[model samples]
Target chain A: MSARHHPADAVLADYAAGTLRPGFDIVVAAHVESCERCRRHVRLFEKAAGAMMSDLPPAEMSADALPLMLARLERNPPAASADAPIAPPRDTRSLIERLPVKRRRWLAPGVWVQPIDVPQLPGDKLYFLRVAAGIRGLHHGHSGPEFTAVVSGALRDGKTTYRAGDFIECDTEVVHRPKVLAQDGGCLCIAASEGSLKGQGFLGELIRTIAGV
Target chain B: MTPEPSIETSEPARELAPEDLIVAIAVRADRDAFARLFQLFAPRLKSYLIGLGTTPPAAEELAQEAMLSVWRKAAFFNRSRAGASTWIFTIARNLRIDAARKERSALAYAVDLSEEPDAPEQPDAIVSGAERDLKVREALKSLTPDQVTVVRMSFFQEKPHSEIAADLGIPLGTVKSRVRLAMARLRERLEELL
Candidate 1:
């Protein structure tokens, strides 16, 4: 974990401040589970947010607020139904293991993509990318911000290699081909993007057109 | 006339910190304790969600759901890690994400926002406690209005730097720097409490 890259301070601040989109938040959550340092930083940001919240002027509430809450308590069984259950203790597995829905399909040989249903994001933009070892991805540039968190194994984009728990954010300025390292079992990643990826070269364009990432 | 907020003069439940009340609910599933917490935070949560552009009805419903989560997940609260306001706010924030996503897709929102502690290693409990100090409040006040404006925009408006720039008619870089500077100052001042 020490050698893995972490999310930038700005991104972590956005996550703690509740400003990040849901799709991006998922990527950050996956990374936080693996990086203790980022987790500590996030806690501090939460504390700061709390202080800010305390200082805001209190807003008036309806007369029924407390009564409604009490009613809910009365109606709910001591242990309620399965709706919105509390999270089980922390699972060390990748973020995909925790996903409650499965609507995945294959994009290519040794490459599978699962487009998560995040309502607040562009359709088909946020998905999981699983690539077998020894496979190489297309050379691509993003139309907007793209965040990818490695759940397991390692992948190399140009000279930088991202390992499990590492987070990589690329924007329009970045254009590279990512290849899964053969030494690792393979790579599973939760990836999110603000817009569609724009691929370079014929093979890259073909993959991008078919995958629609 | 609207009801006054000071009606609890004789109520013994007024002085306890939110952390204590949360722990109470967590350990015993105390309804009264949960009621007090709801009374204190629900309204604030409602206003917060509304301020972030959620419609009034939706915001109210969101607030209710957030409080319900507080009751259901109280067992996970760790006072050594977060204050009551901080913990509650985190719950609200997570709910907002779920709420936003649920509105967009047919898929049910099932991911746990607070499934794990923010940090693997224990954070300094002092920072959570110190955030409430008068000095920290004064430090917040010490920021230039522009800095404060950007901070508020970032945290409350949920507007990105580019959007904030467009809204304020300033350059995006200026907006980014303002937010960065404000956070640095706030973190520096708050850290001194330790």
Candidate 2:
């Protein structure tokens, strides 16, 4: 199936530009893996990113940069890192499987979180959140930007219902109370939040205490 | 590694585009051509890395790695898919990401299931890569200075939207709107070329 919702153009542009925080970039990548529309948008942005890089005024390099690079090229065959195991181009199952599944931890009675620590985003947070069917998940407002990409099942946050491959972005102003859609077998999503969660009501405070989001 | 003083002062540098240099290297495995490509892009790549928050020494290393990749992967360069500048720039970008993530999978941003580009209402099938690049350049020019500033800060500075808003002393909504407006215009202009 196709994605009904996708990340904003700014989000995709940042992703293509290689400037997005590693925490958010992976979630966006997973969504792009499954959404053809977003994939095409990202390609257009990639071209734009390339053009922008070309337009920047030149900067001085260390004097030995060229000589060193040339020497390396002559002495070595192309680095074999390109042949390293990349997530298969078309199949995302392999990519998802690569997540830290064995380390998953339960956050609440019916909620589980598997943290994915990206090296670049040591200060930020990325994790997989799984909520069992019929369970109302956390109700909270973001202290910073929060991005979520649904990988399996579905979630309903107020008026919008996000299904697999759907991308959702919530800023400080967006206070959402997401519930696992009862029809689906539960919901599994990879979420990247810029900072801490700011709980609103009493229930939100309880979740905040428990999840430490 | 021998010092090629002539290449440093060559007049052909004025006439040869980066795209031509890449094609030269791809077709003939020309060291001089690769050197020229290295001369043109390495500094810029280093600058880009520094801007992305990498230290100067680290940026230099990454730039060197990127150029090496270009030399070995020249034959894979498809002019129709990406221009030489774009290809080299992508290599540098990927190198930075790889260093940060320390994963062979860091280039996953370029990996997508759908290889086909979206078909627009008016199919511009004959548009060349150069033409597309020109269109993109023109679209960029069409953006207002405010929009352009916001876009640059977002893409080049690697600043979050909130940080961009703070740096420019503008409201967060304004920053988002500027980015949204500029991107919508770009998408409309480039949709046919896709």
Candidate 3:
């Protein structure tokens, strides 16, 4: 899709300052993933943020913080913790699985999710997924700018394959098929649709309806 | 640990377009580069956050979190569209919006998702008669106190409307009109600055 600019200045300024609500932040992030102009402005903000972070009083770890952490490590034992006795590592799960899930706003069998590491946001839809590989999900349009970063595994759009930790931004102008490329682990992704998703046609609408999303 | 002065003070600190390169070094687990990134952004981020109605501690938390994200996700940096700082800046911006939105009502004044951007219609650069940053500053100074408050508060709010109400303890409708008036005045002020 053709790229869109970043959110307007007031919003951009707030975003740069790190004062926006987490939900709104998610929407802008998803949009930033796709829009370069917004990214450029955001870069300026990040530079400013870095400079500011340096100015803050040094962040000291809690007194005895290291020992407390170490004591926990010793009690659990590194070997035992590695063994995954209590919470079995869904080897099928990605590292994102270990993090807290964003509250799922839209959930279904084919898709459900919980936010992870995101602060808070609004008008942004967070989706979790259990995709069957090779399923050709409908090609879709971004109603506005959208950002999707991979919390785990990956999904493919046309020629690009988004792996775990990858950041993908799509604007309302994009039209592409997002197909899952089965990783060693099943793919798990965190997607924030900034505004809304414009289903390509009846087919896309059909998929959304079936999933009740 | 900070490197010795002999260690080159991180990422060469020279290249005119070191943005992507800065991101690359940061991705390599280089704390010094990360420090440079922090030096580049945190203040503006803080100013922006303060605009949102967040307490100082909350704003600082956003800064730390955004920076940590740079540390963890620097490797994902892509240069085709923007520089490293911009990419990270956008992340911080998005996170800030998220932080303010949790307990608030839906983002009423936020971007209308249904609307699509005109296919990259290049905004004619607002002519900065002075230097680029200077023009922004000049425009800021030109605004009335009310306008400035609106702009500053704009920087703070997730939705922008209610924060004005809460900040000023006025009604929501009053906040909306004032914001509109301030924005209109700002656009005019910017024209002179440009």
Candidate 4:
């Protein structure tokens, strides 16, 4: 599916350069897996990186480096093919299913949160939030940027509707409540937040206290 | 290892391009070809790692490991998909990421390494690796020097736009715009080539 909303060009460039924080990177990657245009953008950025690398002045290697490499090569044979499995065969599961979820916590009656096991800096958080159709999410503002990739179904925030594979980035200035479209069954989103949520209302504060998002 | 007459010695007059050298290793398991590839890229790879703030000794080790990966994964090289340098750069990039991940946590985080199924090919995706590399180099040259500098800082030094703006003593909005403009110019130039 083509993604209507995408991460900004600078973010994709960072992803290409391997410079994005792990939490941000995972969210972008999930979008890229489904969005061909962003993938093309990433490829171009990577090509730029490769070209720049090719033109850099060479660094000195230790004199014995080549011989040491040759010795290591003698012990390791080439893989039969690129597709030859280094990891176990990946089953035909959705991205959310493949990820290791730490635990599921009920945030509300129809909404539950499952934390994805991703390495993050002390203040950063990554998790999946699945809200049943017609449910309105907590009204909150981010302490820092929050990235979300829609894994399934659809949600509407403000005027824009984000469907499966769409990406949304919320900065500190964006404070709003989102609702899942009733026709879409439910919405599952993988979100990465740089810092805690600033709850706007009493209910928002209660959910934030319990969810620790 | 049996001592065979060196391919370099036998063919002293002919110089194989990096792409051909990889193909030679893949098809014939040619040691001399692998040696030639190493000589061409190992130093450059080390320099790249160093540019990204790796300590010199660690960069050197990572470069060696990257080249070793190139050797082991030679059979997977598809010249049509990526040029020698681009492919090698990706190898080094992945190694750096993996190394950083290891430093952060002892338990392996389930980062998905499996190749996602290919999307339907777009028009530009069909461009051959060598041609695309050449086009990319040309496109880069077409960008303004300031634009190039921003691109380099973002890609090589791994600086966020805010950090880059701070380093350059410019506004963050200017840095963001420069990056956006640079990428647009590149896409335009490459599209013209296509």
Candidate 5:
């Protein structure tokens, strides 16, 4: 989408090593909410990390450390959260659910051009367009590396059509004109833009503010 | 290992041994359980900060701060979502933001250890506090170089794009792309392992 793209390798390593931040992790979580490409990437990294952990020699903790940790067990201690099935918040789920999960190139109604959901986010910038059917999306505009995915349906931007599971990246040099192409009612889309929209006209701004874009 | 003696009826000590118990005590607001939690997490917090590139003093202080949060916010831990190591990592990861915010220039906290020549860098010692953390370096090495850098950048500073740009000397957009790609890749990798 941009002059460059996020390397799949780096994300795998970071998540594997548990070095990523929560906010950033949330962004990635949002993307995983819609996109499978990024999901696959995360899965791969997890595997690699597990292998590494399995291979490394165990660190010898102080004798007291284990006892200390155990001694506290008799009391009611804090319970930590697991990383399994980390579901989206109710607001996000409700918004995404109303729209179809798997559409054939559907676009939200608005001025936004790219029609895709499932953004691999938390990088620098991410964009999401929550438009309804028959709504003219944002006019042709370019921003930083913009990755779009459909949380619901599909869309057609010029020749390159996008589907529910597809991932789209439109970088600084690329501007898109996206239109919804779903037959079963409509779709919901979630996109991540590297930077704010560029070259958006007055109409774009007006619509964006109106739609809370 | 002589599994820790069952709870002493006198003290509602339900914490310790398989970390689940630790959580149980933590839920009860047991101070001793909290101390145990502190003992377990304090060192990892320190190393994670070090990995992000904090000074020893700063890392120690930050680690202590994170432990205190565990003590205070123990109720928030959802064991069903993560186990001990991973959940603690999440806590430290969340707190890392606060640490980075303290210094405007901190991009995330990638401690090269070697970068700070004057500081006695104990790359292994710092990380060894948590056995799982000790494995992180190797796991990271298993990823592609591009993925590695972006993920590392995420940990180095609290500031999202701007600081990442400065620290890596790349454009803001590039950093974002890298993170997107990295998360996807990591998610995929972890899934395979599971």
Candidate 6:
């Protein structure tokens, strides 16, 4: 099913233009992979980018550029088979499951965190959060931007229910506690946040310590 | 001074569109077609990379690599699905991302991200890929000059929206709004025309 929530247009433009931070890009990709509407938007943005590229003033190539390219072509001729076999359709595993996670830390009775190994600057965090059904997460706000994509089940933040494939982007000013829906199965999400998350109080601090975020 | 005898000045291939040249390469293994394609795109790719902060030599090397990929991947080109320039631009963009990831020693994830199943065809998508490309180019003309400037800076130069606002001496919110407005306008215009 198509996602009800998607990343903003400006965010999609950044993703298409390849300017997004690596961690943020991955979360957006997970959403884009599941949402066809957003994928079309991304393709449109890419077309615009291609048009802009064609209009740029051409830079001069080195004097021997053509000759050098010809040499490389000669050394490595085009393969005999022009048509490669089609790639098999991807399996049903969630995006988080496909990634090579470094470790899984037990945070609470119904929750755990797995940090995905992606190159990141200090203060940046990218990981997967799995909350068992009916569990409520810590009340927190972000110091910078935080992006999340629901991989399975549902989460209730305020009035909205973010189901599988839905995208959520929260800025610094927003603070709220989100809970996994009681009727649905547990939820798994891939999230990338800039700077450390700001926990609200003592309980929040304890959850943060156990989650190590 | 006399002009050099470059492929750009040649008679038959000079008239072919970039798309036709790619088709020629795919159907016949035509070297001349490949040469024409290289002559048209390599320099522009280099200029693009340079704008994104790659050094001149590295940009030049990457441009060559991108063209080499075009040569190898020509058979996969589906003119009905995407314009030659759009396809080539994606190739170059992926190479740049790969190069950046290699430099950081990060795991290679960008390629796999794109490998997910393509969206099912939309019923309203009646326009061919080439027609869509042309319409998008026309829609770009409808945007105000200021909008165009931000689109170019943000998409081509890789400037963060915050940095763009700083460069333009405007508030950061204005920069984000301009981008959002410009893209919405483009999408609306394309829908109307297509």
Q: TM-score for every candidate vs. truth?
A: 0.79, 0.85, 0.38, 0.88, 0.51, 0.88
Structure candidate 1, residue pairs in collision: none
**Chain A structural similarity (TM-score) per candidate?**
0.82, 0.86, 0.51, 0.92, 0.53, 0.90
For residues A51-119, could you state the per-residue lDDT of candidate 5 as single tens digits?
Answer: 332333333334465454445344533444433334344332333343223323223334343322322
TM-score of chain A of 3: 0.51
Cα error, residue A183 of model 3, in Å, equals 47
Model 6 C-alpha lDDT per residue in residues A98-138, reported as the tens digit of each score:
66687888887799889988666577889999999999988
Q: Which rank order by lDDT, best down to worst?
A: 4, 6, 2, 1, 3, 5
What is the Cα root-mean-square deviation between model 6 and the actual structure?
A: 5.2
Q: What CA RMSD would you report for each candidate?
A: 6.0, 5.6, 14.1, 4.7, 12.0, 5.2
Q: Could you give candidate 4's per-residue lDDT for residues A31-51 as a string of tens digits?
A: 876777877777667777777
Number of colliding residue pairs in each model:
0, 0, 62, 0, 107, 0
Which residue ranges in model 4 land beyond 4 Å of their true spot? A82-92, B1-14, B103-130
Query: Higher-TM-score candidate among 4 and 5?
Result: 4
Interface RMSD for each of the candidates: 4.3, 3.2, 10.0, 3.3, 11.1, 2.8
**Local distance difference test, per candidate?**
0.71, 0.73, 0.50, 0.78, 0.48, 0.78
Candidate 2 residue-wise lDDT, B1-194, digit = tens: 11122333443643566665655555555667778888777778877878888988898888888888787776666555566666777677777878877763443554732234344423334344456567778777777888778777766887767888888898988888989888777766666544
Scored by TM against the true chain B, the candidates give 0.74, 0.79, 0.51, 0.78, 0.51, 0.79
The regions of model 2 sitting more than 4 angstroms off are A78-93, A200-206, B1-17, B104-129
Task: Estimate, for each residue in B1-194, the C-alpha lDDT of model 3 and write its tens digit.
Answer: 11222234443643323353344443344444545555555555554565445666676667666666555555545443333444555566656645654522123112321122322434543221113344455666777787777665564344556656887989977876776666556555544443
Q: What is the DockQ of candidate 4?
A: 0.46
lDDT of 4 by residue, B1-194 (tens): 11222444445313666777776677667777888888888999899888888999999999988998888888887654566887888788878877876432111112322133224546445455456667888888898999888878878896667988999899988987998888678766755663
Clash count for candidate 6 is 0
Query: Fraction of reference contacts reproduced per prediction?
Result: 0.35, 0.52, 0.15, 0.59, 0.16, 0.45
Candidate 5: tens digits of C-alpha lDDT, residues B54-142: 77667666665555656544555533333355445545554655555443112122221111221233343222113333344544656
Tell me the chain A TM-score of model 1.
0.82
Candidate 2: residue A175 lDDT (0-100) = 80
